[model samples]
Target: MAAAKDAIKNRERLLASVILVSLICGWVAGLFKHHSDIAGFLKQALPGAVRFDSSEDNIYTGLTHAQSESKKAGFVAVRSAHGYAGPVTVAVGLDANGKIVNAVIVRHTELPAFFRRVTDNGFPGRFKGKDCSDQFEIGGDVDSVTGATVSLAALAEAVRVACSDIATGRLGLLPIVKNKPAIQFGLPEILLILLIVTGFAAYGKKLPANTYMKWVVLAASLVFIGFVLKRPISLININSLLVGYWPRWQNNVYWYLLLAVLLLPVILRGKTPYCSNICPFGATQEILIKLGGSRRQLPEKCSQFFKVLQRSLAWIAVMCALVFRNPAIITYEVSATFFTIIGQNWQFVLLALVLILSLFIARPWCNCLCPVRAVSDYVRLLRRGFTR
Candidate 1:
């Protein structure tokens, strides 16, 4: 009994340590990424425009005006809007006719790769010539970045808010339209629905030799869910849900489908087929283990340690997400690295290490570091407790 109590105490200390380290790392990373001060950001966002010293004539809320030295270049409003991760500030240049001359991102907390995708795909450029009259709906007037839907939507919202404020409050022009909802069903949504239905039908029932069926589902997940759709269940998605950044269900049916497939089974059956049968990364690791022809297991004590470590990592990740209110801060998973091929160098290195290690050990990442596994295990524990 004394040894058990000591083990529990040690586990609690380890958990506390992990949480502290994760929070510190997240704060430091945020500061490092956003080291370019607001002044520098404004300079890049509004070229050739000097900050106006006089604050007497400012009309729009949460904005500062800047104009060129020549006075013929018109004015720009530097404003900010709430984004997925945090505020996304931008400089919206306005012509004499109240039309947008140009817009530039001043600062944002979106993931760097997704932000790059938005810029590279000319997302900001689309704001040019748009005014208060234009409805900034994602599908109607603005095309969102394919993989970075939330980031793109945030950018669009920032531009729209800035432009509307300038046009209505300062320019004395009424907005031509109110905000419109962006909602539509497409191929991705259909595919997700089909996949979820198939998973529930196959795994939710008791059938003989279901192992072959699980293999088929795994292959489909690796191909369709991972490569084609590129929408693997990520820690980011989980964090977003926790932080109330739920994607609009009308436009984000795929997200809804994924969440349902992951959650519904766990709620009903105390486990999800996603981890064991449908996770693309798990499928890849299994394939590698088979091909490498090495099956090894850690000692019982080591395995127990790893299980504790896994739970601790998951706890730390959740705490970081809550503290930072930024999903990107907890993105230690390798799903994006494999599917999107766009992630930090450390993430790539980690992915490589995990794959190499999987040759000798079965599902090493799932056993040692997967937040999803930790969550599943917790849910199962709760179910067992309630049953007892």
Candidate 2:
């Protein structure tokens, strides 16, 4: 019976793990799944037009045309730049006398509303008469939009690149960069789904996996990386995405869905998949555990200090998290301001040390702290005496 119980427990953990992984993965997939739709919606909401050419009777064309009057009047390229998130390509048409003609967003990797900074309110029109030596930095000759400085910088960079090309007479040779797409339901997604399904089949009815959920998890993860990672890849960015764009119209739909998936593993599977498999942020923290595996020395006196600090921090964060109705703060505990701003260099080292030492101490971070796990643990309590 003891052996059977252990097997059962293991199965629960597997299911729980799959659930946590699926939630995170699915979130990302939704983004990629609807990326084009999102872009199109934005375009319809706010519009910008692109102009081609130095002046009247002349134009730079997307596709080369045959026997066209404008095609024959290709003029010298004098591009403009603005800083942007990644890179932005803008085509600025100048008159024969280097007078500004028109500007348009040719190509860029910035988010929606972000591109507007390039062609907003005659902003691009401002470049018409200025020589190449005019100042265009933010708050200078050109104004930077709020909440889009990086994207602005990237656009500026591209403009600079175009100008360099013009100087080298390579404007005609500018190569366009387009986004590449991933398979909608590729083999990886299929395999992951199969693995999840097998777990559910073996344990769904009797143990946690009685209802196979592994496949669902596998699918979510693939989508997360493909879609979510593209726009909200970084820790801060993802956290922001969850908060800023979490579907909140009808009774906080996105937040509730995330809560259900994140907490499901512990309740049904008896596993900590959130920490074990799905969380990229947690994965980064675990590096410290691996690094300090061999040479970890315990300080008996200071042990209580770390515990107190961790616990106090957790409660404070939990309270704030509870009030804000945001779960990101819980994740932030493991990666607080110290690690985020001041102690960044040491983050990798500390995470490695803690993760490796956990092999001996049974998840020191999860036990002493880890806001997300704490939430899961809290949610699990409500489900006591139940088996699902």
Candidate 3:
């Protein structure tokens, strides 16, 4: 009892230490390194409202880029709400007469391409000096960002707030930064910390084997799986349907849409549906241990050879998808001919037989073969605040 208590106390201390260090590092990295003369100008332009990121030195590059056209269209915005990932502070340009000018994306808080819905093909440029009447309207005149409407709404709000500041003489904007990471604020850092912290929370400590908790976790897991695997009605799964192209590339919207509607209702009906009750992949190893009143430790030959190879392949699949940007490779094997060939290959069938035996020995597919769940595990770790 005392050892367990001591361990818990140690965990608490470790959590605190990790959080503190992360915050300090993120704050220092976010500020005080890169200089922003335009940020200084924007600071002067709108004190206590928004400013340039002190990290990357690119505030004024926006103004310089727009200088040639400022006389033609002119832009004026003290702040921008339509951010890349989250809300951001941006220097909106307008014509001399207070009309909106070029919408220079001053800075954003998300990774480079996550918000491709907003940033792709210069989507933000469309808003340059857009009339106040134009907001979230659906049409080619205003293209829809695939999976990120929330970002757009927030961005619009940010811009409105900044404009209000200026209109009411509560703010002004004359100065700006030089280049890159156009805006800086505390919220983004704090949010990043919380996100990392959530990762540990999602990791979850080993809990007592209470039946109730087991049911809850199982149900929660199933519900999560159902939602993610649901076919594409929106942008979240657009990648599934897209094969890629140029000049008005297209998506196989109908194929995925049909699968979603048909498969969802049917899957919800079965005792375990596609995932296997208790998660075949989840419960395989446990079942194997108690198979038909006969159990034995896996032979070293089987464990050492297959287990290591499976883990290595899984890692390669995940890294290729994550680092090399190959979702097609990441999500599934993705070849009709490959699927056909899988059954015919003798080695593959033998592997399947071993997996089935593993169902008696352990969760064979989940431990070694499944790729989606592996990625989910990583996201779950981050969500639970377990990086510490």
Candidate 4:
């Protein structure tokens, strides 16, 4: 029995190492391919440019060729900003007068629906001929896209950063280095921290109000983290961090705080309090089960089969995101469908099925299909390996 257990541990660790190595290699190859594709995107941003000066970095100079003259057309700079899902990269074309001639999204991992909304609402066109120094803030100088504020902000920031690079380097503008922003500790962070602390403090205690407290925490998480903020930790965020696409810490304190809330407990105690006690979607299902007055659990064999399927799907999703270097590619998270009411047709259908099934089984989604649970399980496995 001991030998068998040791062999299984060795196999699991070896498989994990193989997967990690493959992901790194694939990410590196994708970077080279993406680099080759940027020149074409730059040309699209600056159509009149006949040629561009070669450079290894994100900044470049465009040249227009006449019969005997090669004159400087403008400068192009590429920059990326953290979006709702992942990084949004834009290539900005600046004329000699330090005005944006055009800007194009070179690459992005934003959700297709949000990206489409921005494009349909003429978001990029709003930046044309804008001065490089102009504050590209949404709802001020730039128009905001309804239902896509995060995407719009990210796209605008990408363009603004690129323009600032060109303005400071070539156009001789004063550097705009502001002091580092203070941590954004807001209602969301406060609420999340309170929920975690209260939940852990009350767990497994014999107090009469313990059950009631759990429900209260769940309800609060559902309302704030789900409907109001609409920023539940998802696979997209996890993949972003894993692939080195971290958001700005000061501007995204809630993001980092949520990650810590989810990860620290697992790292320290091998317990996942967030998913068990604070997941908005899990709360929704629990509420549905309570209201429907049915709590039928799946048979053990069937439950085991579904658990395996869930882990396999999660692994495949993560691997695809890493290899393609786009976290949003396989983001069919049902939480997005239930909370923000944002997702595709299929996601809505999946959400409906999960909700319907919740009336029969207790947390069908959490028990059978949640990617977060799968990730936590793998993390715990790693923890066990290291502890041993």
Candidate 5:
């Protein structure tokens, strides 16, 4: 018992040391790369002939530029707003008349595919003619993207704030438009909350664990969360939190509820209800397992080694995200493929292989490579450590 305890302690210490070093190194690397990236982005986004002078204010850091040819002056403000995965830094250009000239995404940690969607759909173009006088509310005046609503909303809000800063601070104009209400509760949020509550009731043994009940939950997850919402919790979600990129609570009720449902049970009872009961990919794998009606167990040593590999991959994913400030770079999970049905060829192949393997092995992906499970295990370890 004493030897085993010593081994556990040694392993925990090693893990903690590795994580600390990785985070410190990642932060340093990110710092060096981030400034150059921002400078390049600002140059590209702004007009070529104008020289930009940094604003004197510390709070609203911006650039004041005067056109060499026309002598027209404008301001470029860099503002950040909360996106679905993280904060999006946008550069907003305002002419001296308070009219928006251009809005460009300077830097963001949003998912690459979603970012592409936002760009392709001309989300930034909508703000080109708007001024501080226009209300920047989505659905009120500014239209939001269908799939990338949160990201679009965030970008719009960022531009609005930047324009407001220039209008009031630089132009000496009084604020004309009232800020839009932040909170928005819709069908998606309601359904997600209900789904989480049902998962808790089912997993907590408050509801009967009948076959029908399981099937109902599985179907709901597959259809609503997977196909319709396309909002399955992923490694990127955890990475966003680790990097201190919290979703705006007022505008992102769905995100908040999902996190609460996934985390609270794990912290309190060591129960990963999200993975075991609520994950759409897990449901799909379970369905495959049932159809295959075959099971295989690896040797204890092999299982232990795979578990270590799983946790290591999780660590690598988080570190990569931290270092690069891009969640898409480290997103290896097949959940997006299953939920969105639109991803790279490599992702498709990976999802196919995992589903095929799930026929013989129960949750092969979850056991070997699921980053979410690894995160849940870490939370469980924390819970156990605190209790001890």
Candidate 6:
């Protein structure tokens, strides 16, 4: 028994080392190819400007297709802001008098569907002719994109900040003094906190009443976290962690709160509190299992095979995300589609299949495809390797 334990420990250490090395190698390779084409980005932001002068403080003077003595066409300012999944870099072009010529999304790690929805709805076009001093508030001056509110806020802020920098530094205007952002502690935050607290309170308790409480929490998670808020843990969160993409804390308190809730138990006890207790998708699957009366379990050999397949798919997904430096690249999770109702045709098909299979299979996606579970497993392995 001691010999078997030692062998198992050795294999786990080896697996941890391999996973770490792959992640490091992927990150390094991605760094070499991560630079955006600034010239192309500027051209898109400021059309009719043939040439750009030297950049000073991220502000580039745009020159028309005229002689050297010609007046400046405009200025392009580059800035980035925290989006829903990661940083969104934008280029804002402003005329001599400080009116916006155009705004273009240079690069972003946001969900591709949400970002595309914003762009397709003429979100950037609405910035044209706005003055540097104008408020770029999502619902105040700029119209909000439905389903992409966080992304819209980030893009708007990126443009606004860049414009402010240009106005004060290059255009010789006063600094735009804006009020500080208040902490957004609202219903969503309150509900999530309550749910997490309830989950932890009920953990490891054998009280009969706790069983009823468990069902209540799960139902609440399904309704609020999954449907109402449309914010469930996904691969994007894992990719963001690996890529060091942190959204702002003031307005995105729920984001940090969720991460802490998901990871704290794993780091402390090698337990996945989120999966068994707080995940809305997990709750959905459990409910499905209850309704379908699926007491079936996969055979030992089959379970092992599927587990290996799950780890491989997850590893490949994370590696691709790191190499490309875009969290949106890892969007195979069906939770996003089910909650947001915004995904590609294939994703919808996959969601339907998963739901249909949930009737008889009992949490097939959680057991055989969740990247979060794979990540949790990796964290547990590393923790055990270090502590033991």
Q: Of the candidates shown, which would achieve the greatest TM-score relative to the real structure?
A: 6
How much lDDT does candidate 3 score?
0.38
- The CA root-mean-square deviation of candidate 3, after full C-alpha superposition on the true structure, stands at 15.6
For residues 1-388, what per-residue lDDT tens digits would candidate 6 score against the true structure? 9999899889879988999999999988888875857999888888968889866587888998768876788999999998877899998999999999999888888888888989898978889999999889887888988889889998989988999999998999999876555788899999999999888766766446888878888899999999999999887887887877877678789988888888778989999668877899989988988899986777889889989988888898889888988877867889988988998899899889888788888788889888889888888888888888
Top candidate (lDDT) = 6
Query: How many steric clashes does model 5 contain?
Result: 0
TM-score of 2: 0.33
TM-score of 3: 0.36
lDDT of each residue in 1-388, candidate 2, tens digit only: 9999878767756754654454455445534432122232222211231223233422232212333443322223323332212224465543333333444455443434434544564444555555433434556655775545555654544443443344234233334332223323444344444433443343333336432344334334434522233211222223334433332223223333334435566677665444444443443334445554642434666655765555456445434333343333333333332222212345556666655556665456655655555445544743542454
- What is the TM-score ranking, best to worst? 6, 4, 5, 1, 3, 2
Q: lDDT (CA) for every model shown?
A: 0.70, 0.42, 0.38, 0.83, 0.77, 0.86
The estimated TM-scores of all candidates read 0.71, 0.33, 0.36, 0.90, 0.84, 0.94
RMSD of each: 5.9, 15.8, 15.6, 2.9, 3.6, 1.9
- The runs of at least 3 residues in candidate 5 whose Cα sits more than 4 Å from the true structure, single-residue gaps closed, are 1-34, 37-49, 56-72, 122-126, 136-146, 172-180, 209-211, 297-302
How far in Å is the alpha carbon of 346 misplaced in model 3?
30
Q: Which model, 4 or 6, shows the larger lDDT?
A: 6
The predicted structure with the larger lDDT, 2 or 4, is: 4
Please provide, for model 5 over 6-97, each residue's C-alpha lDDT reduced to its tens digit, 9 standing for 90 to 100. Answer: 89977886676666677779867866664534555455445542456675651222343443344435767788888877888888777778
The segments of candidate 4 whose C-alpha lies over 4 angstroms from its true place after superposition are: 1-34, 54-57, 66-68, 177-182, 204-208
Error of 2 at 246 (Å): 2.1
